[model samples]
Target chain A: MSTAVLAAPFQAVFDANSQEFSLAGVIRPRSVDEIAYSITEFRRAIDEARGVLYINVKRLAQMNNTAFHAFSRVVLDACRTRSDIRFVVVTSSVVGWTERMFHHLGKIEPQITVEVYDSKFYPGQSFVEDTSFIPILRAQTKMTWRHERTILPRHGMRPGIAMADICCGIGDFAVLAQKEFQPARIVALDHSKPSLAYARKVAAEFGVTGIEYTYGDASEMLLEDNQFDFVTCRHSLQVFNQPELLLKELYRIVKPGGRVYITNEKNSHCLGEPRAQSIQWTYNELARLLSHFEMDVELGPKSRRYLADAGFDDILVESFMITNLDGDPQDFADVIAGWEKMFAAMAARHGEAPKFIDRFRQGFRDHIFAALHPKGYAGWPIWAASGRKPL
Target chain B: MNAAQRQPAEAKFEPLLQFEMEMGTFLSDWHHCDQLSNFMARMISHNRTDPVRHSNFFSSALNELLEVSFRGGSPEGRIGCSVFRQGPKERVRLSFPCSPTQRRFFGEAVARTHKGDAYARYLDAISTDLAPSREIVLLDLAINFDAEIRLEEDDPPSISIIVDLPLEGIVS
Candidate 1:
């Protein structure tokens, strides 16, 4: 529970359970006197706090020097007087300035520390953000596009609608959607700077326009509510430890009556010919490997349940298989090769025994061999789901 | 060199957006600082690689400059802002009415911000018993945004504060 103090253009809430005092909205008073009540309330909360006191300014969109100076005084004074409690100032990278401003405060007092909220939001971010994985991401998109292009229209995707592609790694999907759907606007957002940079470069090289590539944390995005007619977070939810948080954000951004689309993979269901048993064992182990890292590689079939729980009507969910014959068998083989490099490295880093690693490596090599063989067949399954926000 | 002397060649920057209003109208409400910065940031940031992140940083830096101008400028003449872009660098020129005293204050504050120890001086300024000075805010833009700030006073009773921000490069 928390106590709320409402101030014009801003509000302060103190959660007694967490000892966090959160300040949100615009707090740009002309002078300190204008916000004396808030300042006093802030001081009171600090006084009554114990152990650690959190000053959360993650949602503060605007603040002036006057407000900063005033709040800094209270915080500084509290630090000097209270030796038992540590002061932590929580900021967001989305706001851009809060971290720098509060970092100065941290320098002034050793007891004060600044924490950027979204820094640790994604546990599996490092694995996918590797630039070496770019080629495989492109190939995977090429394989999925054959199915999604037809499936998207049935899920309410139409030309001239405003759309957002959350977690748009390297942004190939946005570029393809722009050509096919002609969205009035496209905001392709991702947390990886390198990926976004590559995406922008690719868009520029192709002379693609109208897609606004942006950097953001998907779970705690700064995007305003109800902004887009269609919001798609593709092959992303499975990578997060908390898929519900991502689903909540997707639900928040889509307009009323608009739809939220998502796609994920069930690694354990991936199948190949001839060496089918080895492939099944390896994929089951792959799911466990990802689970150990707080990721859900088996979230494909669970998409419908996730969307329904997120409060959407007219739920639609379907599955598609990307076989070696989708377009070119080489593309399918190349994707497995990339996955082998990434997952094998990850398993090694997790300290798996060399014998287990060898067997794991063999499964991928066999899968790739099957993908490239003349009489062999290999398939990867994906689930595409969407739900409409209630009107 | 002074702001006027250090001004980049006009042809190098392409102007993106500009807004003008009477200083009296602008200073009448403190909210204008937030509103104008946010509006301008959104309008200019769409074409950038990461529009949302760029706009957040741009708005924060622009809001500080506007707040400083609101506090230090004379409320009698027009206040105009023009934004320009050159590659990753974005430039904002704020021209407003000022008294001779206000001009000296901004001139010295901007100069102080360019000093090597501006971050330390900013910390000292904010921690003092007195109210936060305009220098503290200016140093914020200079230090945090890695901005190049200058004051141009060629027009009498009116001065232009020019801030060149590498907004895209800074955010990441």
Candidate 2:
């Protein structure tokens, strides 16, 4: 027996014949309190449903920060408790909104499937779709600073200590630091709202407080001078268009004697062969393509130099290697899929000869996977760099 | 001998190692636990004077068991642990508060030990390649509920998992 589920902001109708529950309703909450209340109620209703629950966000309109966080929290909470619920967000041409929602929510629990459709669906109605994205950005959310095994101030999350995490993707480092380091307060700055939202939501999920999520270009971070006791950036250092400027920004914000820590990929040295073997040839070709595309590339060994140029002292750089051979199989698959997605996006922007491109792409993927297999090893070098401002 | 002589000589196990820590719910991430376990294993290997076989064995076992225990409870639940080595035996005691769901999940895992091959395989793996003279390994698990307290109490009942390891290579 199935019963019709009723909740504010959601109306779930159960079909006894098909043994399915469809959730759909207008979710135009007027206030933040309303958003929170409605989301909590929605979760309860969905949880109480007898059959499989399929939520439709297509009818949801007028999404604000309050609404977005509420929606994301409900999905995350559902994922934590049960894996059966399916939440779908439909979009038309502008998929960024839907993508951003899934990007942040999916990071916390990558196992939860979020189905997306491009078709138009009605308000106050529900539908079922089994389609979901590959979740390429899932790995970023799972990144943690605790694994670095480097020497930094692991203590002192007191009320007096201040920390800043520049380009803090989804705020993992900042959150982990705040929880473990006992910092009085921390500011997580990122240019992407979706990433920041996700970070804030995670902070809430972990019950972490005393941290501020700021949305702004990290290179031009508007934090006060000498305002922080610690400043750090992780894998995002390599992605910055102007790393020198970002370093200066890091230097500018740190109080005298405060530390700056960073770890980023050594792109060229990643998964390279010692000789001109077929694997090495594939890596070289990829590098050649990247260079031809005029992408900004950073030298891993020059991290210390960049920090010194930005007016920091006592700089140290150490190399760390990560390989799929020692990692989870699922993560290995994600890495391969991520590479394919990146190449496909690049090809869309920068067209190449179809036949040559397909052959090269296939060869490149095959070589990378073969190297990453358990019998083989594909390792990448990361530079862990740290510096301190003059006292 | 006086009073000491009046009683029979109680068999005492010599202490080889001891460590204790309160791990908060933040360690729900299996990777963090894995890294910590690996680091601890390396530290142990560096400290031990005698040659030891299967150096990473204890760490890997701890990692797997920690994952199992973590999954058995809520992510935000805290765990208090004490690990020690006595004579040729190594023992670990983990205590954590559990919800009803967690309590059931834990009970299921403990019960599955009799019928399933995974738990048996893990026990076998841990027992292989011991130091030299050590004997059998033992696992003791218990879930205790507060009898006198009302259901409204904020503090829930606790579940403890203890594993004892006895292996050969003699020197502590």
Name the candidate that leads on TM-score: 1
Judge candidate 2 against the unseen true structure and give its global Cα lDDT, from 0 to 1.
Answer: 0.50
Backbone clash pairs for candidate 2 read A157-A182, A157-A183, B131-B168, B131-B169, B132-B168, B132-B169, B133-B168, B134-B167, B134-B168
Interface RMSD of the candidates, in order: 5.1, 25.2
- lDDT string for model 2 (A53-164, tens) is 4454432321333344455556556666776655443332222233333443444565444554433222101111111221434453342232453335432123357787
Those runs of model 1 whose alpha carbons end farther than 4 Å from true positions after fitting are: A1-11, A24-26, A31-41, A93-95, A117-120, B1-11, B73-75, B98-101, B115-117, B154-157
TM-score, per-candidate, Cα-based: 0.89, 0.43
lDDT string for model 1 (A52-134, tens) is 99999987867778888899999888888899989999998777888888899878889999999877667787897788999
User: Residue pairs in steric clash, candidate 1?
Assistant: none
True contacts kept of 1: 0.67
DockQ (model 2, Cα):
0.02
